[model samples]
Target: MLTNACAIIATAASAQIIAGRDASADDWPGMASLQTVLGHSLFHECGATMISPEWALTAAHCVEDARIETGGRAYQYARADDGSLVRFGVLSVAIGAADLRRRGAGTVFPLSAVIVHPAYKPEKPEAGNDIALLRLESPWEGPVALVDGLTVVPREDNLDGPPLVVAGYGRTEEDGPGEEAFSQTGRQLSAPKMRLQEGYVPFVETEACRQQIDSLVARYGLSDIYTDVAISPDSQICAGAGTTDSCQGDSGGPLVYRDYADPPVQVGIVSWGLGCGRPESPGIYTRVAAYADWISGVTGLQIAAPQP
Candidate 1:
């Protein structure tokens, strides 16, 4: 979540953009922004990745109590009935190159429906089942490939985890002037555009995630803040502690691999963390490969493997 007024109230501080730089050089045709609109204005509360022509994946928390700003004021909105922070109906989306840095420029679309994983329980702190699928009113004709398919790196191959690329339009930094540098663009409706930042961080194995979390829990006396699903092998990936990590508005975006030449395949979804980029707090992302079959069921589409 964001520490700023208009920033997302996610795990709270949309976190610090830190070392992540502009992602314009990278080709992410499947990129999408889940906009939290108020009246006639809109602001991106979280990042989303289009996994299919009609589906975009993001964190359920992104839409829950999503942050918004209008008339120079910022506030949090959540309608438990619809599981969205916005009151009105119809959430808007911009797919096929929806870059915030580009001033919300991209293919605009309407959300016909939103389906959060049935198992997901937002009240639980363990961060269980944070994944959700936004059903586009229609389908996207974007250049990026849908992230659905059987192509995935097995858990056994997760040795030492692996490096991945993350992108989003969140707070630029944890604190100081840089933090508010983008606040106007990110939270204010004046410009209504924000900068998109990206970074590469290696995935931490499940065992490692548990160990580190345990140590941190006990050391910091944070047992009351964590849950069994915090870093479960079947559901999450812990990545990067201090060097670089995702935070705040970065939630619900894609954690993908860039080693392959055929664009990149998303392996994780931005979940939660203790705070921003603390030395002991690693970013938690929802493991994507673990839910391939579930995705197919939701979209009624086949999973395609990432090609080299």
Candidate 2:
């Protein structure tokens, strides 16, 4: 996600940590985090999902602030007190395993490079195609994708009522977002509550999603920013309700759904939305299934292991 109307008319960016219950740090072992570290200190940035041993998927905007390197070289994005983007030496991408809030719970990887979709338009986030791929320095010996069968729930205007799980190392409190969501401890902060959170939000119909966003657009007289905040149904999926939703840091994370006995398959990537956990406006995720062929063509790796 980009940010919101100010940045782009009626357009929403990746995410922000917001009101949502805490999920087990252990769930979704494939979950990964992109961070900037200083000495032994780590600052949480964006979330990513491991799609293969050496390849992963995330939102294009998530990597916009990052610099691409020649190799799996290290680069650091140091945040200044003024919140200005500061660079330290060559750009290095640090990847963490599961359990972000927990120290030593996840392992760090050297990111080789990141590839953003050429079709992605930052000025028009709602136009669709908000996906990206990352290549690690080496083959990852960690959790990979579940490809036993068709795990993704297709991007349809009417998915009816399907169960969905969204997990991220994003904001724990809806009101507290951005830098405030992170602790100020000089040392590593113990955020057991903020480690990794998951929410069980029902998949919403595309039309219903459009209606909610449109109502807001009409109510607030945002016709100037956007005439159709309806969001693209083929490129995005909607979820959450009332207080349950995915927030800022949740961007580029995974939206998984189980089909049967096989492990849960990722269907969506945290993309954008109006706000965190708004009653009518739910979180929107990039439909992973819709870009299967694109992902395969970009990364040259199967979305998952060959089905049995």
Candidate 3:
């Protein structure tokens, strides 16, 4: 029953992007923007930091169907074919955009290996440990930092009160589609801090999300089951309202705690949401703290302090 239900929703809606535009070097707190290219066609994807230069974290769903390529090839296609070759691994990374309207000055690197969470189930559409790690072919020689103080379990305190900075190159409106082109670096956008329901972990209401699921199945014929969970291990955060939401292309970007004095820590990973910030539909995110051990184990890096 759960499997069948999951299949129903998996067919609904298109992939949503959580981040949009590129940030000037000063916009992103510690790390510069991250850009990924995959496949021979070089489809562009977004991601953020777990540790600078060592491990880059993002959504596993982004790479589930990707092919690996190089940055040069990817960019060439983007220039020639637009984003038609985006399915390949061609990608570049840049940091500190002097002009917010344009791209920035960060190094573009090829992805050496993509290690996704072992428990990630594409068919479930639940965002369960939906996290992934990108091993850069070379170290980043820019301003990057690790997201620290994340726990593996949900905290009892209210995580919604603080003002969160949600940055990505996702579309400004839902279902409107993102920029038809790709860039070496991404932009940083912010959302007003909405209330996070810590105790009330909402599940995907099959009935509510049915229309989306039905359409997706009809068009893509996918068989994954989707739920309206506020936030799950799958890294999806549900938000609904109007234009104030994450859209297609924001996947794997960071939902950050930029209010901190020392460094802005990545609290969640943008995965999926219910209709792009619709009313009553709070945005969901992959809780970064809950997977600290798993991330550390996979990357072989020391966990940084949370408040530092």
Candidate 4:
């Protein structure tokens, strides 16, 4: 059943990073670059977080076409109708490294399986339920390990909580000049940093978030693009400050809340937004806490309770 009440929202663009800083080598150990290999080139499509050695979490839209057949043993590949294999791209994960180009800095694992949430609607991303899990072909064998026992909790409505960090290899500019801007073909381009980029964005209270987005819709005359409820507070989290926000290429990445003296915990997954770093149009993320049980059910891993 569709758990979220609001399945339709406005301008559901994939998220990325805008005006973010470069991440250090030691930061975000669980950060995984979702890559696709075509011929001799490897392209970074989106971001993911390695939850376990063999399991990683990302957005459903990232691998929406990936299918696992009956008996859970065969992969479905595009065909030419002539019963011949159509060469395309292979999905994989590059983990343990902040910079993707550095050889030996990380290990790349081919995807064994991809499971998208049943409730997810590719056409209506703003309606919530945009999460997915990727099973690694094999367990990671690197020193950059993942921290287990990370669970999500409902964030308070107020802004008293600390800022969250969003990291990815997405474009650094949008609607502006230079390489990071969109192409004339209207495709969102990536002028990602050689290393992972990160930005600190404050949480936008649910009610305030909705109002601000509504104002944005009115100002830009986006009534045709967005519905009455642009953000579903129950299944989505809003976070952005100034020009620092998630935009294209950052989808499926983690929005981690790190408190002092405590291990960092991922609270959200980059889902959609109105525009790149627009005022009042905060980036929306899939609330991880809302689907905790679903994730556990799909991956068959017993998620630990959050510490008090």
Q: Write the per-residue lDDT of candidate 2 for residues 1-308, one digit (tens) a residue.
A: 34453543212244544554555544575677766555645665667877777787888767755665455464645447686878754322233444443334235566777777888864444556877888877777766654212234333434557667777766655545444233333445322134567777787877888888777667766677664343676667887764777766777878877544656678788877766666787777787777877877877754443435
Stretches > 4 Å off in candidate 1 = 1-16, 64-90, 96-106, 145-156, 159-161, 176-193, 218-221, 227-229, 305-308
**Window of ten residues with lowest summed lDDT in model 2:** 147-156
lDDT of 3 by residue, 30-122 (tens): 332344434322233444553656457777666554444454122212212342433332444443333223444445465666776888775
Residue 300, model 3: Cα distance from true site in angstroms = 2.2
Q: What is the lDDT of residue 292 in candidate 1?
A: 79
Could you give me the TM-score of model 1 versus the true structure? Answer: 0.77
Model 1 C-alpha lDDT per residue in residues 1-308, reported as the tens digit of each score? 43322232224214335577777624665776666545555656677887767778888766554333343222435665555445543366666433443443337676766677778775443556788777766677765433523344343556254557777766555542322223223543311125667788767767776776677657755565454545686777777766577766777777776665556777778877655566756777787777778878988867665457
Error of 2 at 6 (Å): 5.4
What TM-score would every model get versus the actual structure? 0.77, 0.78, 0.63, 0.79
User: Where does candidate 3 stray beyond 4 Å?
Assistant: 1-23, 30-43, 67-87, 91-106, 150-156, 180-224, 227-243, 305-308
Compared with the true structure, the alpha-carbon lDDT of candidate 1 equals: 0.61
Judged by whole-model lDDT over C-alpha atoms, candidate 3 comes out at 0.47
Model 2 per-residue lDDT at 147: 24
Per TM-score, the best of the predicted structures is 4
Best lDDT among the predictions, by candidate number:
4
C-alpha lDDT of all candidate models, in order: 0.61, 0.62, 0.47, 0.67
The order of the candidates by lDDT, greatest first, is: 4, 2, 1, 3
Candidate 3 Cα RMSD (Å):
8.6
RMSD of each predicted structure: 6.1, 4.7, 8.6, 6.9
> Ranking under TM-score, best-scoring first?
4, 2, 1, 3
